[model samples]
Target: MSRRTPYFFLLPAIVFLAWFMVVPALQIFYYSFLNYSVFSASTFVGMENYRRLFADVNFWWTLLNSFLFILVTPVLMFLSLVLALCVRNLQRGTKLFRTFYFLPVITPIVIAGIIWRWIFAEDTGIANYFLSLLSIPNVHWLTEYPTTIISIMLVTIWRGAGYYMMIFLAGLALIPKEVEEASLIDGATIFQQTFHILIPLLKPTLIFIFVISSTAAIKIFTEIYIMIPGAPMANKALVSFLYQQAFERFDLGYGSAVGVVLFLITLSFSYVNIKLIEQRG
Candidate 1:
């Protein structure tokens, strides 16, 4: 019950986090300056890895693709907010709709990505099968760069929508009913109520989603890895670049450089998330 007792209780978690997270993060920065693999002795290379990375044509392209992934944030926000509104206005089956949409959120990402890869298969996949019925030819869903990124983005959106929708639903619930009723009495149209009233009140919720979702977009790895498993050259993104260099190629120093960059990029967004949460008061 003493103030010091609270610190004693928290000590274990603090120690665990520092050892696991902080130590590895520091190691990554330290190792990035070295030129070595797992088997070889590390030699301090003085930013040689970064110089090479910057010189690599694929690195710039990969960086662009990583930013491209940020597009998912706005798309997710729109879909989730719209779905939240729809569910809120429904007369019944609210639980059913919520459950159904949220089902994908519970499914394991690797398993879902594997199923989606099959569904998007060029010739015999269900996605193409449906398109066939509509007289649309099979479009290469996962093969080409453009479609590959788009397919991954779609999967991200589908998997994320239900969760964000629930958050929006919570935000909607917090709004006072009297404000809505007052708006209705003022003869505001649905569009007017949404743009003028609901959106303004939901600014905090929207920004919260934006920060978290943007962070996720930056760290995108699993979906691209799963979908493009066989095609290493085509897999161009910050994390993908890191994986290929560090794990696949066994160039630990080069890989650590990519990791450092990825860490910095994700760290900035994480800082924003923390700041937003603090200011949320």
Candidate 2:
């Protein structure tokens, strides 16, 4: 085989990455330093956009909201691992259960959001109807402050858990049966086996899921956009804030600044997670 064969095979992927990922990232970075709005002429005002972004109180709030939203990651990870473990040992109907759980993952986020929005509707929604049966007042799921954020988090968990479950299932499959049998022979409880053997072995998979889910939580926009259409202050996520600034308000430079900050945050989180996992290992 020619030494150049590997490069030939990699060329397509390299070109795709350069075009789709690298180029767009560079453009966003460049735009973050300028006063580029959709309606006006572009002018380079180095650091001004960043300065403005730092000074904006709402931007800081959005950042806080983004971090708060990431609280869903733990819930997602826990549920996914549990479900994966449950289905991993199933002797029958395993495929059916997996398909049922994963249906929400393949469902369009827009459609999911719409369905959830109606389900949680303030007046006539199913949630309130159930509450009414219990003599409780109609709880505002989306319009309320923390509840609005919580609603989105719940939707995120519902959509993401099964997807991550598949990752855990694959990791579980890679775990040697001999080790499990040895643990069983040693009279280890399921909990003990999971904690001592399964979890330790699944570290890499856990870290990957953590990073991916954290990033997804931070960059959450579509669900918020569709579920809470007008983006009330109580429910606004960082990406939703950026969308309003860039598309709705036409402040592209500021929006790009937000994007850069979001990128840095996600990168930092992923790095820290991987480092922590490595240190633990």
Candidate 3:
């Protein structure tokens, strides 16, 4: 085949990327430097929007919340790996278990958010009812600061764990059966084999999950938007803050500045993950 064949095949994808992702991202970056709003004429402000963004107390708080939200990454990685291991050795009905686990992934985020919102409601909610049965005091899951954050994190984990579990399952499937058999013959315990052999081999998948889950955690908006429509002080995420600025308040330039900052933060995280993987390799 001619060398041009590969380029020909990639042309459509390249064009799509340039037209959609690259153009839109460039526009956002340009807007970040302006004093643009829906109601006002655009004017070049040369980083004034970014300066104001950095100085704003609410912006700082939302950024802090975004970082705090990333705490869910470890929990998600651990639980997904554990679930993958449990299902990995199953001899029968594995498909059924996988389907059930992935049900949450396929469920629409809006629906999940609404359902969780009601579940965590202070009054006439199933969560409080269960707690009442256990003789525990009613706790406001979504009305308070840390509790609201935790509740959103729980919903995120529930929705994301199955997807990561599938990735882990694929990684596990790639392990050589001969290596496992040799370890078994050496009288290595299941724990020893998993910790020493399986986990080390699964490093790439772990890194991927870490990067993806961390990015998703940072960009979380729809869940918070749906769960707390007005985004009360306790539940405001960075993206929701951006949404409020751009759409609600018509501060388009400021919102784009927030978007740029978020992009940089997520890019840094992904870069760090890639570096760690490279060093491990």
Top candidate by TM-score: 3
TM-score of every model? 0.93, 0.92, 0.94
Candidate 3 C-alpha error for residue 204, in Å? 1.1
Candidates 2 and 3, the one with greater lDDT: 2
Better of 1 and 2 by lDDT: 2
Flag regions of model 1 displaced more than 4 Å.
Answer: 1-4, 232-234, 272-281
Give the alpha-carbon lDDT of every model. Answer: 0.89, 0.91, 0.90
Q: What ordering of candidates by TM-score runs from best to worst?
A: 3, 1, 2
Worst 10 residues of 1 by lDDT: 229-238
Model 3 lDDT tens row, 119-231:
98888889999999999988888777878889999999999989999999999999999999999999999999999999998988888888989899999888888887755
Among all windows of 10 consecutive residues in model 3, the one with the lowest summed lDDT is 228-237
Q: Per-residue CA lDDT of candidate 1, range 209-231, in tens?
A: 99889888888888878888766
State each model's C-alpha RMSD to the native.
2.0, 2.0, 1.9
User: Which of 1 and 3 is ahead in TM-score?
Assistant: 3
Query: If both were scored by lDDT, which would come out higher, candidate 1 or candidate 3?
Result: 3
TM value for model 1: 0.93
Query: lDDT tens digits, residues 66-147, model 2?
Result: 8899899999999999999999888999999999999999999999999999999998799899999999998889887778
